[model samples]
Target: MRMPYRVVGGTLVAALLAQLAGCGTLFWPERRGQIEGRVDPVIAVLDAIGLLFYIIPGVIAFGVDIATGAIYLPGGTHAQVDPATLRPAVQPDGTVNRARLQAILQQQLGRHLPLDDPRLIEHRGSPEQLAAYGLVPAA
Candidate 1:
């Protein structure tokens, strides 16, 4: 009993493509659930797949879970803060007070974000605030 050449070729091609796609990231571990504090979703799903010996559904579930927004999006131009009313004056070095900036962000965003981290507050200068600071928007 031998498989057809076409069947074998198709299987080989599919396996090669799957390997090239780097499916490992799909199974990457998420943090332990706060409730259980021990069950790792990724590992649990993977272990279930091992028991079932069916990879497709496991891979699909893993991809869906990982692609979900567990990560925060970087705040860009839309996140810029108004300097005047916010009351955080930029210093000579073009930096604002960390605490003041955090306060303003909390007020505007209605949540406490880590503004002390430059990454969160980078590119956060508002044009209206700049105008009040005697600066004009670059055309």
Candidate 2:
């Protein structure tokens, strides 16, 4: 016998599949042009499956990230911006200057980051662009 969780999961999966099928109709024109000939039901099913698997997770993750108020940039340091000053200070060589570290932190993390939160500002990393200058993380 199937567990209760399994039954709910199966129901959710079926609902998702139905929604995907309805959505496929909207893309028929684009698919027709790409396929260049006969409309293959098998190919359409495969494409819809792939689309559902890829899009749903990506959208959920993006929504969660936004809700948490955090921005993750690839290879870039995350830092809080100073709402009052709106700048992260840098040294003459563009390294993270401890004296003007607040400004440096803002610049590295981008103006969009929440600088009002002291917790986030304190945890920011050094900018990759300035890493070669032998600069250390500010305490």
Candidate 3:
């Protein structure tokens, strides 16, 4: 009667929806239709129902697997997942703080090769600096 037709119509609608949401087993049997590690709520519920309904495929696959001696290789129907990662963000901005940098540079360089006089350092590379420091005129 009317009850029979009602049930049939409802079953058809549910089946169509299940297919649309990627339910059922075999192939992309999404444990959950997850996006970025979080499963869609509707899909999550559908997935649970799908798991229950999947007994059909699960049984068939069992037979096929036993016949074929087992194989269930996931090929791209799987979701790629990674946890949120945090790392230091550093950059070399590339601007030489001329005065401060040069001062530190000169200080460090002095540690390895001591400059004779602080005065010669001021007029660096001048003939007078070289003569006073005994580098050019004095070998």
Candidate 4:
């Protein structure tokens, strides 16, 4: 008789790969309260059962980075905000509208990068403007 477990095992491995391939959004830090209804129950059950092994540490690190006011998520650096979008956040009063800046930056980059982030300071002010604010631009 043919080996029966090979068929079952192969199907399980394929399903697992498919589930992981689609989990990109599920792990993103910005997906809170929005991404929903697409879970594979099999994967969900497997993940739930194995959560402590790897997922818990990742979640804890995400939480700690959030508490620290980090500009990006914990894994790696993301691209800087486009200077085009950053330009308009300058208000008529000549101050950066930090609230507006935060919203735009979050939408464009999926991270809460601050206007004063080093990556952003050059985009925000001319040399004279930065001096007026008692700030210096990096070369």
Model 3, 4-53: lDDT tens per residue?
Answer: 99998898678656644543233335322221222234434544454455
lDDT measured at residue 17 in model 1 versus the true structure, 0 to 100: 56
Candidate 3 Cα errors over 4 Å, as ranges: 23-44, 57-139
Give the Cα lDDT of each candidate.
0.48, 0.43, 0.38, 0.50
Who wins the lDDT comparison? Answer: 4
Model 2, poorest ten-residue lDDT window? Answer: 29-38
lDDT of 4 by residue, 1-93 (tens): 356788877876765554443232344435332212343343344444334435653354334333332313234354776666776776645
Model 1 ranges with Cα > 4 A deviation: 1-83, 86-89, 116-139
Which of 1 and 3 is ahead in TM-score? Answer: 1
lDDT of 1 by residue, 1-139 (tens): 3669889888767654544343333343332111112334544444345334346655564444334422212233346565565544445445567777667777787766665433231355677966667665554
Model 2 ranges off by over 4 Å: 1-11, 16-65, 69-99, 104-113, 116-131, 136-139
Tell me the deviation in Å of residue 108 in model 2. Answer: 11
TM-score of each: 0.36, 0.22, 0.23, 0.30
List RMSD in Å for every model shown: 9.4, 15.0, 25.9, 11.2
For 63-96, candidate 2 gives per-residue lDDT tens digits of 3333332222122333444433422454444444
Worst 10 residues of 3 by lDDT: 82-91
TM-score-based ranking: 1, 4, 3, 2
Instruction: Give the TM-score (vs. native) of candidate 4.
Output: 0.30
